[model samples]
Target: MLHGAGGSGEQVLPYFTALGDRLSMAVVAPTAQQPVQTTSNLDLAGIFGSRFRMPRWDLAGRDFPLAALRWALTELGADPNRCVLAGVSMGGLATWNLSMRFWHSFAAAVPLNGALSIWESFGTDARTRALLPNTLPLPLFVVHGGKDERISPEFDRESVRTLRDLGHQEVEYVEVPEGAHGLDTLGLAEGSPLFRQLERRLCRASRTDQSASISHRANEDTHGRAHWVGLDGITPQRTAEVHARWTAADRVDIEASGARRVALYLRGDRLSPGDMVTVTVNGVVSPVRFTPDLATVHHTFQNTVDPGLVAEQVIRLDVPQPPGDEPAEPTNRTRGRDAETI
Candidate 1:
């Protein structure tokens, strides 16, 4: 859970605590670290309706919120795989942005009366537009008040429309006619429609496997990896994408763009030691033998802080770029540069 602008974690934590008690779950609400800063655009005053600096989520940064979540999970000994993210107003916008960047971090998301600028933020750029669909696999329940004064309901509606246009089918959008800025009045109630939906969905929720077939996109290294696939040596300010899937128990197919290297994190459950794993990247085939490392499993757990994401084996492949592209050598790791399989 996250708090809106000018709000503290204590404000939302109590509500989440009661809701968590009812649902037999643990809850944590993290406060935004920075206040809304001044922008050079003069229209910002009229658009945001702010005369002075006020608290707001840092939509551009991913570190603070993610670190808060890790801290909460560690302190409470909570199951990171079973987490759900929920927020109201400014926090709701953060919910949408974070969910899009890190879909694997939560099972579902609830954004109530979000102050969103979805099309303006992500749709204007061709690179961001292409990257949006890859991060929307998880379910979302979006709510907005029809009579909101501070932020218009059109924002939420347009966001939902854009999401649907991007091929997201697991979204539910609700508009409360009598509600105002504080839609949480109806949304947070124990037996409300929104609450009931959350109960039903969370009761049976299960996260997608990290080793499962994946299609992911990223612009920077801060939030690059998705599922079991990772990208490195990507061109700055350009979107890098990777699509990978298991064709057979020991065969994998991959496609990459705007990246100099792609990595596949394989686990023992998916493939055995000494098995000849066939990999195909951008129409290039390489047959490499699998080798499980116990240290990799431990390091993966340490780095990700999620047991479900631990991998016993890892394979890296260098991507072939067109002429005039100056992609650097990866600082991480990889193997199987030659010997075509087909």
Candidate 2:
């Protein structure tokens, strides 16, 4: 479990109580790294008043909360394959970002009254808009308020549309007619439909074996270029694929089998004049055309290798830096901002 901006683990403890005793599961509510003295009802009209903002979960780039979650699961001896991630407000935004990058890590996800992307909240760029269709086909239970003015409900609706368009079949979206940003006000009570859906997903995961799964790891270089690594499952029959949202100077490495048709999805809207992508499969290099939008690059090798043999394929994108003298600084929009109230 995670808390919203300006909220602590103690603040969200009541949400755990609402689950009741029907679900017997170990829960871990990790507190944020930074704390705020302001409560949920703090006034935000004055700019220089007694205002505070807690540290965000770092969903966009660093993903510090994900590392903490892994440590928590290890310490508690909990089965991460059967885990469920639920959050509210800014925590809800982290839910979407984390789950999308680590699709196979959780059985299901529940995000309440949250914006799907940074584009929905502050503004839009090519990178943010490109992340829309990459929502994985995980069983998602979304709850929002029709009267929420802080974060528009249209973000949830558009997210649902993008998920459905990307072939997500098991999606449940519920809208409270008169609810606000609070979980209780959103109708996630003891016998609510959201709980029922979560229970069903938990039951289904209990009967399946998900020991072999694919996971993604992301890192950024000192120059702000992103790097992604996708590890396929151990089983031979599973299809190997990599999905990534990249800037111009990003690099990706995928471990795949020769028998599998590797599908690579690359999203970049700021392709330079001489930008080119080099795909190296088992040391055979080939240059591919770089489009100004999303591109699906597919490669199938005729030399069939053993299904168990995994080979590392490299994709190096050579993009010249933009001709500007100003250095870019990373910014966190969710931090130091006033949070929506109940």
Candidate 3:
């Protein structure tokens, strides 16, 4: 797994620490070459903008991810192709860039809230947009949050949309509600354990075989679906009165494990008998069927986000609200691990 900009290796370590203890897969996260000094403790946008100076996954960023993969290969006595590249934000950009360049070098690619803006950062005129969705057979999982402010949901949407539009079947997209953009929130959240499960699914003894399939127990695709359902529409004043705030556009409190079928529930007052709604998983837009039973309504989505990006993607599902047994509201969980809430 990889870390985000101005972040360190420790970011992606804990997710696999337990797995390393059992399967003994060595977990590695290298530091960034340059660190931007925060001004007035408010420079996420500026520093991140600077990251685009080069292709996100270009040599400057790829070096560490590559090094870590090399180290894992050496320690495991396995080929480099058996590795998985994953990261968040800038690191995620590196993950995508490296994975594309060395598609055949690894077993799978996982990028959490990453983009292809490296060329913009360096003032390069290369056709990066054209180069994306290139000919690569490796699987990828891309995660994002719907409410992400710094990177915005459109960034993740466009990435997945392009790949899907290009007809690349190996990609998967996941969006979470109320997911934070900060690394600290993502690294510690219990929902973030999805990474551990994802790694196990993509693990291979050797990276030499292209046709080999890594096993993923969490293979429930939620593609081709979308929906807009909120609680009677949450109100901030009402939340504070009850020690709560509106989440998921003011409704929903459930966890998603990519079930083959996703059941959505809406508050009674949220939608009427004739209300119409739809869902967007990844970028596949699809309307949902309403089965109102009280103030609750729900739907199941198949293959919305790319699957490859989900399991192996270094998702830092935001934890803006306190981390507890309760999951973030569904619609708000768009950014995956890139949430400032986490």
Candidate 4:
């Protein structure tokens, strides 16, 4: 849990108190550094408005609270895999930024009344546009005020749209009717929607493995897929000719444990007749054939490994490659892109 600008970790104590013993997990709330100096020319009410912006916690590559949080997690013996990143306002922006850069580190994220990108307050450029899609597939539960004048609701809406367009399946957004920038009016008690969502996510984390997967549409169309975890050796380049679809040669790496089988689901329309995909698990490879008549192809590999041993599995397609073009490396943009309204 993180705090918004002009706020500190202390402000969130009430939320913890509200949760009581329902939340047994350790909480870490790091304060944002550097006081925001006020200017006399600015209207105090206007400054309090949602439109008024402050320098982000990590602006210009300074990561005060994030670094503090990471250290605190270690000291507290917290499970990184079960951790949740959440915040409001400027802290909401920090949540989005940190989650993107460390997508594999957390089970879920909740950003309230936060802009999808810093470009809402800061300006934009071509470089920033490339970074927009980096926040893909991580489960996000976004809450915003429909009547929020501080940071328009459109930013949150656009984020959901862009994520869905990029094939992310688990993004959820909720709007509080006539709600303002703060969630004070919305009860944060047990059985409330917000508490329920957090409970469900934490429960899922405790029961699931760390296995991660990426879709080709995320890579080719939206440029949203990041590098795979537990990857070994060399990474493949995306051939130029296969830019729009998943070819037989596209590959994804997954680090698995306590696994009995691996499943690969492919969109049939993307494959040409007689196209084949290869699934490699711990140095063993199996080839799968695809036909035009099929709408989806499900390939399963039978292999069992001990849960204690971390294994790296690679899946590559055997498709035609364009001449002279290097395989496309996965794109990773740690920063936010230009803001686009819904």
Give the best candidate by TM-score. 1
> What TM-score against the true fold does each predicted structure earn?
0.83, 0.58, 0.49, 0.56
Taking the tens digit of each residue's C-alpha lDDT, what string does model 2 give over 75-171?
6655655677777877777777666555545667778887655443434323333444434447787888998876678888888877788677777
Cα-based lDDT at residue 17, candidate 3: 71
Tens-digit lDDT track of model 3 for 28-68: 76766542321111112333443333222232222455555
The collision pairs in model 2 are none
lDDT accuracy of residue 20 in candidate 1: 82
Best by lDDT: 1
User: Candidate 3: minimum summed lDDT over ten consecutive residues — where?
Assistant: 215-224
- Please provide, for model 4 over 154-197, each residue's C-alpha lDDT reduced to its tens digit, 9 standing for 90 to 100: 87887788788878777888888867887574445677876776
Local distance difference test, per candidate? 0.69, 0.50, 0.44, 0.50
Q: Under the 3 Å rule for N, CA and C atoms, how many clashes does model 3 have?
A: 79
Residue 236, candidate 2: C-alpha displacement in angstroms:
34
Clashes per model (N, Cα, C within 3 A) = 0, 0, 79, 8
User: Could you tell me the TM-score of candidate 3?
Assistant: 0.49
Candidate 1 wrongly placed segments (more than 4 Å): 35-56, 115-130, 183-187, 325-342
